[model samples]
Target chain A: MSLAVQPIDDSETINPEAVRRDFPIFSGSTQPRRFHYLDHAATTPKPSAVINSISDCYAQCYAPIHRGLYPMAEQATSNYEHARRTLQHFIGAASPDELVFTRSATEAINMVASGWLKPRLERGDVVWVSRMEHHSNYLPWQLVCQEQQAQLRFIELTEDGQLDLDGTPELFAERTKFIAITHVSNVLGTENPVATLCTTAREYGIPVLVDAAQSVSHIELDVAEMCCDFLAFSAHKMFGPTGIGLLYGRQERLAEMAPLQVGGGMVDSVGDGMEESRWAAIPARFEAGSPDMPGAVGFAAAADYLSSLGHERVHRHIVSLTRLAAQRLMRIDGIRLLPHAGLPASGIVSFTHHNMHPHDMAQIAGEAGVAIRAGHHCAQPLLRRLGLTATARASFSVYNDESDIDALIDAIISAQRVFCE
Target chain B: MIAQDLYKETLLEHYRHPKNRCDGPIQDADAVERGANPRCGDEIEIGIFLQDENIRHVQFRGRGCAICIASASMLTEAVAGLSVAGTRILCEQMHDWFGDIEPAAGALLPNGLQALAAVRQHPARQKCVLLSWEALADAIDKAGRE
Candidate 1:
């Protein structure tokens, strides 16, 4: 297998055989030693290409972006800006200026919560959010509302793990400032109609923020198409560095919001005296002090890697694996399948055995060298509605194949034997 | 009392064939306590019959990894006739006997119960290994109060 190097969505696309070649660890597995990685929703294993890119950024052209005038600094600055541009195009933004770098999507949402929305959200304002968002997306809004005396309303999720679109229209009102939602559920593998939802929110003149952490890696995303006010996602899910993530807000929205972290680099001028600290431009204004340089560089390489491999293919691969995983998991006793819709699921299949705890199941699976995830998966409110405290989740990715799903299926049966009948 | 080796085999046998995995409807029971391993979401409902602070009978009705249920099985055999104080001491001995924690430790598998010794190496499975016994101890401690 060779590495892919094509652009996004050409009919004569790059084959995954070429892409899978780059992930060396996916091959050569023994019985219990098999690295059955079905936990991509938590974090993806890095590709050698992205790992080398990080090494190169650190070893060769390590310098502060937007700080030094030296050649290495210039290279670092260019690499960092290239990553921003890659994200700009990847998410279908109008300009690179619309993309701002943050440590992770958590920080990005916190930036909006603390810096941008905090000062502006008025008391008694209604902020709507779905019950299905990760804690990172849900908690920040609650904190902001608590601080501002604004009310946080939860838009009900249907039994199928989707917001009731029928009920959703009732949720939007003149007072509904914004609706925060996850583009795809990390736990349920349910893909929300984000673009349509955002479009509907537009009619009511409500700003919508989307948490795309789970969707970005395995989906074809376009911020422009999605019509969101703000889109946030982590880079690590896409085979990039951990601490790097993207926050894509419309240019006008970015201008209206204040920066979260205020420090040296973000200021245009510190004032001659000690009186005032004027802020820099829109993107720079939001980015305070030094940023993760190598992270950004590796993120660019990752963006390049995903684009070259084609996200559409990746999405297809994962969706097919999800179907296979569900079919196999359903065969085992004590597992029930959620009614996932016709659209492509991100990469998660959450099921519980009748007499098995997810963690114990996951641990037994772990002993078999299968890495699956267990818990509320940061969707406790939804889990509570499902009458569950947690679930064992098998998430698929570009690296996963039928064999991996088979491994999981086998591990699950073994767990049943080990724990139950 | 049965040989220690007999108890070990009993533990392994019950581990392979867990007893009373489900408990429902009207039933006579001694003590019942909910055991949850928060780490892995493994929950066990331990039901025991006690007479004179000794385990008169024991049964489990819950979900978890093998070790938890197996340990529950081992627990039933290990402390069936022991007094309350003796039961606690045995639990401590088992915990201590896991490794150098029990210095000058000799041959293991005190029979079917021997598989439990491997459990110490896998920390994640520790909670499963101790779930029933811990719940049993707590249940016995609260049996009179409740």
Candidate 2:
């Protein structure tokens, strides 16, 4: 397939042309338009720096960390820990120990469910989760609630797609034990008022866990400023390699939670005189297996890449592009943008066509070399609440510019002609 | 404008005006089966009526994409009036077609059903085409057991 390399608009704070050069997928294309990747919410394409970091780790410094005494092992171990420190500073964590690496954001939330919430939750307690949570954030709590015989309730969304924060204060009853919510809605791209929700939860003496999977790539995150007890995000969403997720727990909270998995690297000592083995330190204890060494190296590079780009610039690009896309989509006949009540700055726009199915819309877009996600997007509850079975979703990232949205609009119009004409 | 081969005019016509689509569950059906693609949340409830060891009638009800709905519409028309065993064979042949396994030299898919085969290149959409057929297959099995 030939690529259509359109001229980039340099008016934006983050220049898509310069950023696209960093991402190898858009590097060699001279054609006007070949591939318009608008599925950034699903996962971002890795930059050269992140890709090279993973390659360098394996080709030059590959080793099983913490087990080897040799220099290579030490180097791998140092790099892994160095990545942790880099991430700690990236998210504005008070200490590196607050960060625990898991396989995915789903795993991080599961660890919290099984290790932290399970023990403290009583049968009569209630866990309040927002309706906008992706299954990764919702299902874990549902399973834990079912297991513990605890009551699970939802923090409903307003028609405009914002979290119904107005009703939150009264919902935090005495029996409310915890609140888990997302920083942004994966489907609507609505950046929920998490800081306000976190503050409200604190007043009720209930700790909150913020699902930062969508927000981490688009916004600047400071765990201290956010005032959440725990935060979860995935590296893949931020142009890093997959199979690595970060869970940041406040020191006191991490101390109270037991290790989700106990084995090799996470044990302080075992098989001594005592029957019970002492677990390792906070972050180490949570991470039981040999770590994803290359993943950590790549993740650090991704954090550094985003750092260099600056969140302000990234957020501005996303907001401006998303607003533009939404406006253009709205202008098209028979197209209904989800949560038309308000626009989001989070760089995602979901919509449904009156005549065409989302799957068909997405497929037609794909044929035009525009990559947009379709269907429930793993937030079925939110979609159901919006009276939709599925919708076409176009998400933006730092590398995206006006041309991508133009391609998406052309695809949508083409789909309308195909289905409605 | 480039033609969307996947959403051919024929398929879109079938989607716009689905045949044998019931507003609600089919009553007096010999057997019924529900098929769902949880990945995309496409669901189809298909029912079959058997008379003299043949599928006398078939009907489906569901909500899904154009491909899924159109495929279901075409499925009901394709399998109607075929013997129970004949319908099962057709379903198997259709699955093979989608899987890119060429049918036996003499075997060819029915003319209308062949239109849905455009989804073969789009693996994700193949499930949409097959959702109703799988349900029809299970519905037949359910009838046989009874």
B-chain TM-score for every candidate: 0.74, 0.93
Question: Which lDDT tens digits does candidate 1 get at residues A241-314?
Answer: 89988898999989888887789689987877778878999798888879777888788788778877687777
For model 1, residues B73-95, the per-residue Cα lDDT tens digits are 66776666768777767666666
Please give fnat for model 2: 0.50
Error of 1 at A301 (Å): 1.0
What ranges in model 1 sit over 4 Å off?
Answer: A1-14, A27-34, A271-274, A332-334, A341-344, A360-364, A367-369, A416-421, B1-35, B45-62, B80-114, B130-146
The parts of candidate 2 lying over 4 Å away from their true place are A1-12, A28-33, A272-274, A340-342, B1-3, B23-33, B99-106, B142-146
Candidate 2: residue pairs that collide: A3-A31, A4-A31, A4-A32, A4-A33, A4-A34, A5-A31, A5-A32
Q: Global lDDT of each model? A: 0.76, 0.87
Query: Per-residue CA lDDT of candidate 2, range A1-421, in tens?
Result: 0011122333448777878989877755664556799999999999999999999998999999988999999999999999998898888899999999999999999988889999999998999898889999999999999999998898888778877867766567899988899998889888877887788778878999999999999798988889999999999999999899999999999999988788889998796676889899888999998999899889888888887777787898889899999999999999998884237668899998887788888888887889999989999888778777788899999888899988999999988887777
- Whole-model lDDT, candidate 2? 0.87
DockQ agreement of candidate 1 with the native complex:
0.23
What DockQ does each prediction reach against the true complex?
0.23, 0.56
